[model samples]
Target: MTDQSPSEIALESRQAKAARLFSPSAARNRDAIGDLLAGLLPPSARVLEIGSGTGEHAVSVCQRRPDIGWQPSDPDAVSRASQNAWAAEMAPNMRPSLDLDLTRPGWDAGLGGFDALVCLNVIHIAPWAVAEAIAAASRTLIAGDDSLVYLYGPYLEGAATAPSNLDFDRSLKSRNAQWGVRARSDVEALFAAAGWAAPDRHEMPANNLSLVFRRRSPL
Candidate 1:
């Protein structure tokens, strides 16, 4: 057996290509992420995943937990192709990829509401506005009582640690002026302002942290 580079795996299809480009880490982290989700997400939850990158998480979540319905959305057409491919391959409780760009207004016109939402590594890659939009839109999507919003990614801990995150943060800023790792307190504040509250934080293998926020009020 051989491990393939993202470009090597991408040669399979358009969807695979997107997966290679965006979610190259899926093969490594999907299961760990799913473990966290299993505890947070409802048994019969409908999860709307924002920035579904390669759709790797969508497929893993649906396949591992058949009780949940997984919906993936991405703004990039090429990325959506990758997500769609995985959705077809898995054939579990999955929905087609949506053309969702949180930076725009009225983005959820046709998608409807969800019992849960998941976002992995999006906040650090995109502008602050992206995170802001997601926080605002979440209030409308989630169902009542324990409807979860799970965010997984590297973030600043107010204190600081392992030089890797500092380097990663620098790299992010270098790539895009608007992109950079955000503080945990800032993220929690966003949820709080939207009438959501944070649960306990879980540490992952990497410096990434899983921030769980749930809507406290009914829609």
Candidate 2:
């Protein structure tokens, strides 16, 4: 095959853009997260991802891990549209996007049971109550001890993870009175109260940590 001319390449690029739903963060860390999931997630797992945002991660993860089925949800219409558009190219394992808001009731019933749950970049951007609601929703959706929930994003300990995150947290608060970076201990307590425990924590690049929580089996 010969190399395509500039006009042909540009037309192909435009065609690809027409085919897409939307664009989001193409951080190298997405694959890193996928690597973590490869080791942590079981084969043939059913994963419900909350706040799928651009749906890029959802599509990539599902494509990379054909064994796992993914359900991507977001409260925003544009996000869902983007997710739907991106998912058009993926396998059937990628489920339809749902309008899921962690703050609301009845989401658990709607979502039903899942083997695992993954949420990225939500806790730090949402309110404290929203974070609690996520834990509660996880408890309701998981049926066994082996069920896992992975949260990825920036977190703060007594010491700041990075000056940039600290500044980002402050800016978030300034922009929205309800949004701010959450502390790891506080999040841990929320998980514990919701009958989940953390067995491992993976520190990612760019001051973000991937925290995995396991739901306690029903007594």
Candidate 3:
């Protein structure tokens, strides 16, 4: 095929810009997530956000906390492309989106340590192994004693499962046998084995939970 003309490239850019994905859930929860992060992250902290779909949370957080250095990443090409578009309007503190896939081997090879890791609405949709991989990788990725790993998603916690959550879990499992709401206890244990302290669970809107895990000192 011949190289596209400048007008063609410009048209495609406009189309891609118009195609940036927007999640209703993100629209509803971004402020809550941003408020939490504003308090959680230290000034000038380097935060790596995984599964940054649509980049709304990243932009919101960056706008709220200019002191932070935000790096957003995703595994899907479509999501990453969308991130690029959304991230454009963010402050200079926001880095270009990285195409990082935690499930892949050597996911953190070139990347150095971060002050914190943030992942929202990702775990339950992915296979269980993704959680294990992130837990394992986080151990090495954040070395400071107070380094944090923030994960947000629906979960089966102490109280009886909310009807909405139960139905959502069922729907997930129906679509993908490997996908379903995870037991909080199971996730706690998995992270414990990876040397993280028990997460401090924060109840969120829509029956979701924000689990904040702190890094532990090496033995």
Candidate 4:
């Protein structure tokens, strides 16, 4: 056994705390999201997840689906740090987080050929252009007929928006004018423009929705 200095012990404690950052929403929705993904994704699939916030979802989902390889990414340095720390603790299937910004051009340049792409609670908090870019990139990266693009967040469905969702959308817009719940039809149109088929929407907990879009067969 090696002796440790007090400074070393303090540093170790701080590092440990930083590694285990918590997100209440992630904890609450991870199981529901995992169940949906398990049904949609194939065994041994390669999945790339965008906006992998606290990295909690990456660890949880990867652990639940050990056969699926997971790549978690975020644009924020702090988020990447948290994801890297979580990946270090999780199974080998979880890769270290990558630096990804949906707003940037060529964001998916080197990251292609994925079996699936997942973005949770992202679009509602980002500019509409981000959603368009994501759809465009998904079309380019996912090559297989069976590949999927999975998106999860609140959405406006014509005049059927829930009261809670309306409040949430208002709060989001107050934070950033560009950020708010997107219209489902508009989102579908984005995918359609990218040569993707119409999405299948599933109702999730807390008025959130899970949209699964598939690529159309080449003519």
Looking at model 1, report the run of 10 residues with the lowest lDDT sum.
Answer: 5-14
- TM-scores, all candidates, are 0.86, 0.85, 0.87, 0.88
Q: List candidate 1 stretches off by more than 4 Å.
A: 1-22, 216-219
What digit string (tens of lDDT, one per residue) describes model 3 on residues 63-101? 898888888898777777777777775557778889776
lDDT: which is higher, 3 or 4?
4
Evaluate model 4: give its TM-score. Answer: 0.88
Could you give candidate 4's per-residue lDDT for residues 1-219 as a string of tens digits?
A: 224321100011122266656677877798899888888887788999988887877777788888989889887767778888888876578888898877766678788878998999888887887898888788777677788999998999867898899998899888778888999999999888988889988999999999999877778
Would you list the C-alpha lDDT of every candidate in the order shown? 0.77, 0.75, 0.80, 0.81
**Poorly placed runs, candidate 4 (over 4 Å):** 1-16, 217-219
Over 46-164, each residue of candidate 1 has an lDDT whose tens digit, in order, gives 88988887777777778778888888888777778878877776645878888787766667776656888789888888878888988877878776686878899888876665578
RMSD list, candidates in order: 7.4, 10.2, 6.9, 8.6
- Give me the displacement of residue 85 in model 3, in angstroms: 1.6
Which consecutive 10 residues in model 4 have the weakest lDDT in total?
5-14
Worst 10 residues of 3 by lDDT: 5-14
Output the better candidate (2/3) by TM-score.
Answer: 3
